[model samples]
Target: MTSPVPPADPHRLPVTFRPTRTRAVLIGIGVALVVVLTVMSLLLESFTTGDRVTFITTGLLGLGVLALLSRPKVVATEDGVTVTNLTTVRRLAWAQIVRVNLRSGDSWVHLDLSDGTSLPAMGIQTGIDRQRAIADARALRALVDAHGTVHSAD
Candidate 1:
């Protein structure tokens, strides 16, 4: 008889990046706006189907933007890194990354690609806590150092 395969360990999965306070604020604001608008709409005695539709549509659009804020994140695995932004999610291997830059005046940590292009890691922003952002950037740099390919200074 064939031996049974063992289940993989759950703790060994890729470590997810820390959540941001800015994202929480965004979600809070969006939810608050939606609630206030919904309450107001219901209070209006002259509310019609068209008005309801408009209110719902506006709420959805606003909430969608807030949802995007919650969606962005950076995950670091042994294989590579995953960056999810507002409009896109990119998976990049260690070899594809050139550098990680987190500096003053920048809104977020940006990844320099080996292809001479750059991508912003919106998951790490400098809005809420500057110290925390710096720390996260350092941690990400450590990940890059551990798994990324090294290039010679030509």
Candidate 2:
């Protein structure tokens, strides 16, 4: 059973973009790996101090990777777009945006800035689900067109 999606605000742009499958798979794998590692570490009967440290560090690393995978997103609102990539989160006003690009060969949607800096919209990933990615990119372009004075690349 699926719950109905809430209606979007007419005056505001859509909320956010997300990768369909890749993120779920990655998050599942990350959580599973961390759990397995932790269980094995705890079950071990003997452990040196160094071994304990290494085991804990490995689990923490898995959690860190999970955080990274789950964090990236492109959020749009009446004010602007917020892009959260692997290591950075940037908020840009509509006027600062130059274009949104999701070319056929590109891995993800890219936001072109007026400053000439291009930022990847990791939330709208391609290759994993091509059609969905295309549709999302188009929707994002529509938002940009409606709220901002910018042209997107083909």
Candidate 3:
């Protein structure tokens, strides 16, 4: 059985939701990979200067990609929500969000907008930790309910 989600305090103007485990894993792996590659490049006596530089550069590029993968987060304030995905950052007013959904089998939470479009909220991902993702989704839903304005269809 699922427990009731506690009401979010309106006084808390800003709240951030992010995937902790995923971010930690990505960063840990990325850093370790970079360090290993760098050390190997330095130790390899057969590799020329150009080869060593290329190896280090490759490692840095891999780290950059991992960093991007771990960049998703959602910041909610009294005024609006700011969602940062892999490459895009979008700010949306409460009214702009018609609904927040995290259906079964969904990888992440999706926000239904008043414009009839859905925005993926990667910060509340279910892949790494399902329970935490569900909680975060519920919290986001509560925030939307409290702050979002209803738009009547014409």
Identify the runs in model 2 with alpha carbons over 4 angstroms from their true place: 1-14, 48-50
Q: Write the per-residue lDDT of candidate 1 for residues 1-154, one digit (tens) a residue.
A: 2232232232343756545677788888888878877877788889997897688678878988887877778888878889998889899998888888887798888899999998999877777776676666776776676677743211
The residue-by-residue lDDT of candidate 3 on 19-134, one tens digit each, is 88899999999999899999999999999999999999998999999999999999999889999999999999999998888889999989889899999999889977788888
TM-score of 2: 0.82
Q: Where is model 3 more than 4 Å wrong at Cα?
A: 1-11, 150-154
The number of clashing residue pairs in each candidate reads 0, 0, 0
Q: Model 2, poorest ten-residue lDDT window?
A: 1-10
Taken over the whole model, the C-alpha lDDT of each candidate is 0.75, 0.79, 0.86
Off by over 4 Å in 1: 1-13, 151-154
lDDT of 2 by residue, 9-56 (tens): 435655788874778877887878778877777778797667767887
All models, RMSD in angstroms: 9.6, 3.6, 3.7
Candidate 2 lDDT (Cα, 0 to 1): 0.79
Clashes in model 2: which pairs? none
- TM-scores of the models, in the order given: 0.82, 0.82, 0.90
